[model samples]
Target: MSSRSVIIDNTDAQVQYSPGWQANGSPNEYKRTTSNTETQGASFTLKFVGTSVAVYGTLDIVTLPNTTYVLDGGNPFPFSGQPQSQIQYQQVFYTSPSLPYGEHTLVGSCVDGGGRVILDYFVVEIPLEIPTNTSLSTPTSAVPTTLGSKPTPPTTAIVGGVLGGLLFLMTILVAYLWYRQFRDPGRRRDTKPSFTSAEQDAQTRPFNAPAMASSSYITTQHDAETPNHYSETPRHRDVISTVERHKSPHVSLQWNQSQQPPSYSM
Candidate 1:
């Protein structure tokens, strides 16, 4: 990021000094060339690479005239010399703003009414180290290392697969149910009950009733006022009736009829 000055001798510039111009100074000196010609077109062009450029020359208010400075084919600017009795060498007459970092040309011309134009040298302000395509070394601590040979699959794909499988199973179950409904519309209504008829009757039967009964007898009398005695009592009769009403084919019942028995002795 440091900057340095590049000095170009006036002898190295492309000088177009017309007749009456003098080249009297030494080539190694700062002000190597001088032109006192009053011609309007006496000029010098210098090419250099830098961010900015300045022209170094002798300025004299009594001898030098107003000079024109043109940069990169742009508009020219007039530089009026200050009133001074003595010639000053290495004086910065004009300087340009920071230009692009590349080659550029600057032109200095003397006006017709000007007295003299001295070409001392040129100064170019440039960076000390110009950047190039060379590669820079990176610290090992700043670089990252590979942790594995292959990258793992994303969790979203695995989750999507599980969800897809569950959806497929649900679709199949729903399709099966729809098919069953279409094939047998009344299957739900016709389904067998969990309990059988015998089991239902047993559940409804009285808890104290006998599950089975042996042979039983009954007698009927024509006289309503007289009471008829049977082998089984009235309570046993009621149990027998209940068993006969709800009896299944597995159980057997026998009945006997007889006239009123002879008067029972107390």
Candidate 2:
């Protein structure tokens, strides 16, 4: 009997399987589960070559308790309008009915459409993987620090804050000194004092002397200049002196009223 090769398509299964033991790919074997938890269901594919003389054969599902046969012989599998020759391809789906938690076997036999067995024999087995106990050791060491770790304040900000504080203090001191100097009594000027009773009397005494001197001086000059003219004049010296004194407050004059006043007022 010639050995048949099986290709395990891991791309669809998404699992890693160890290489086959006896036949390179004959019923590829793999550990599905452990003794405690055995795998119940599994699926795989098998390929074979047949000649026109082959017709039918039986594929075996060997479990511990017993063996199950799906199809005893082949049927006329139609391709297009007629049966394919010996070089044709065929596939079959087979699953064991909940086998015992132990080793199992899948035996396949290929045949033509006329109940003729083409393949001599076929066999495949799936195994269970056993895991062992092991320990891992890690080293204690320092780790690299991140940029956000222990962030320090900027140097420029610190310098700017110190300068701002000094500037503010200087401005406050200057303002305080200016306010104290302006409000102090020692720095203010003094105003003149009010007059007393003695000072008032001295100022008024000169007022009376100025008035008397003006009156005598004017009368003596008038009489001496026009003694004869006074007797004939209608207007007397007293009228002229009174009119002159009334012109301004600064002029001091006094006139005797020995003669009668003017005709309009006397």
Candidate 3:
């Protein structure tokens, strides 16, 4: 049920009332009404309870030779000038209590040519009202007439500087962590990768890929004189076989001749 309003005219403006300025939804909270006779326009804002339910409005008097004015109520509040004035503009807001719910309505009206009040535009709204507690009104200590007021902006600046410095330090810390994790990954991994004996041997040996393939395709040759050792080519076997074959034939013929001599004696 709290409200705020503004009064406006051609050159002058002022805020008439704001119900949410203090205790919000507390019943003890009350709004201070304002009145402006100046020929200017003004703006007002309202918040119900302590919640964000807010309403704002601007009021301006229509320029006419003579007219009385009255305002309307609903979603956005509406108003009309006296019958003498045909055009007047005003804005208003609406609020409700409980639940985070709200709505807005911009309703207006004007006196028609029939001399009857006619609706120009109207809308409905239901605004949420948050609960609030009334704050105690404590009397402020009187300021010394001689001493000037100190500005709080410098303290705010110092606090801001401290916050900025803390944020910068935090950013640096985060970047360092990221660098350790990604750029210097060994340290971040913590544990070193272990190599088994077989793996280590494989890593140390020179990999002759083509030589290995050739060894597999070619036949293995062995030395006849040293059967335990390996040889490089089939020529080793060929040489040994040729020498054995020639020696065998010569030995057999000598034996045959020796046998024949013995036969003559018989």
Highest-scoring model, TM-score = 1
Displacement of residue 76 (Cα, Å) in model 1 is 1.1
RMSD of each: 24.5, 29.5, 18.8
lDDT of 1: 0.61
Model 1 misplaced stretches (Cα beyond 4 Å): 13-20, 26-36, 133-266
lDDT of 2 by residue, 2-69 (tens): 22222222222322222221111122111111111012222222321111011111222221111122
lDDT (CA) per prediction: 0.61, 0.33, 0.30
Tens-place lDDT digits, model 1, residues 96-136? 99875667788778777547776665666666566564233
TM match of model 1 to true structure: 0.44
Worst 10 residues of 2 by lDDT: 29-38
TM-score of every candidate relative to the true structure: 0.44, 0.20, 0.19
* Model 1 pairs whose backbones collide: none
Query: What does candidate 3's lDDT look like per residue over 1-266, in tens digits?
Result: 44222122111121223222111111111111212222222223222222222222223333321112222243333333343333332222233333332321112222222222211111112222323443322112211111111111125567899999999999999999998878666644436656686798999997653212122122232323455544323444345545544644321111112212112233
Q: Model 2, residue 94: displacement in angstroms?
A: 56
On lDDT, who's better, 1 or 2? 1
